[model samples]
Target: NAGVTQTPKFRILKIGQSMTLQCTQDMNHNYMYWYRQDPGMGLKLIYYSVGAGITDKGEVPNGYNVSRSTTEDFPLRLELAAPSQTSVYFCASRPRDNEQFFGPGTRLTVL
Candidate 1:
């Protein structure tokens, strides 16, 4: 089964432009999360959802938003993207905290 999938593996965006990072999972997990990873920094949570119809903002929710309208899809929307938002975005899921699986990652750049 596919664990998690993210689209547009690489992208270059002009400052102020917006895009959506798509994510989907077939694991049937209830916990899904969005995280951003800088060059050498650890993962920083942006948003998460416990299940369909239930969502919460995470540590770095600024400039980003998410919606979980279905059990398998959790897409992240970037509004007015900025240089500060240039980072690798990852979508992950876990049956619990002990086991989390990450997507391939989406590389975004703002110029």
Candidate 2:
């Protein structure tokens, strides 16, 4: 794709389950981010990377992990999914000083 794309548009998980939300982009953006949005709430950043081989935690990184092995992929891993982790996850990318490009979003439900 030319912009950010996320896989598995929807998912259902049980408590303590785990999954990885996949994200890919083709714009060669140097910055990538992972965010989650709960119902009636704003998006919360989970992790981000400036480039491949570099990553950092954001506003809400707990219970989640991320890796940027290349310029085009930024995957979000939920090691032990929780009820509180249920939300719509978004992947975004941007070039330096440019506007962000976002994925369609992945809706996850934890029971």
lDDT of each: 0.94, 0.94
For 1-111, candidate 2 gives per-residue lDDT tens digits of: 568999989999999999999999999999999999987889999999999999999999999999999999999999998999989999999999879999999999999
Q: Please write out the lDDT profile of model 1 over residues 7-111, one tens digit for every residue.
A: 989999999999999999998988999999997899999999999999999999999989999989999999899999999999998885569899999999999
Q: What is the TM-score of each candidate against the true structure?
A: 0.96, 0.96
Candidate 1 worst ten-residue window by lDDT: 92-101
lDDT of 1: 0.94
Kindly report which residue pairs in candidate 1 clash with one another: none
lDDT of 1 at 74: 96
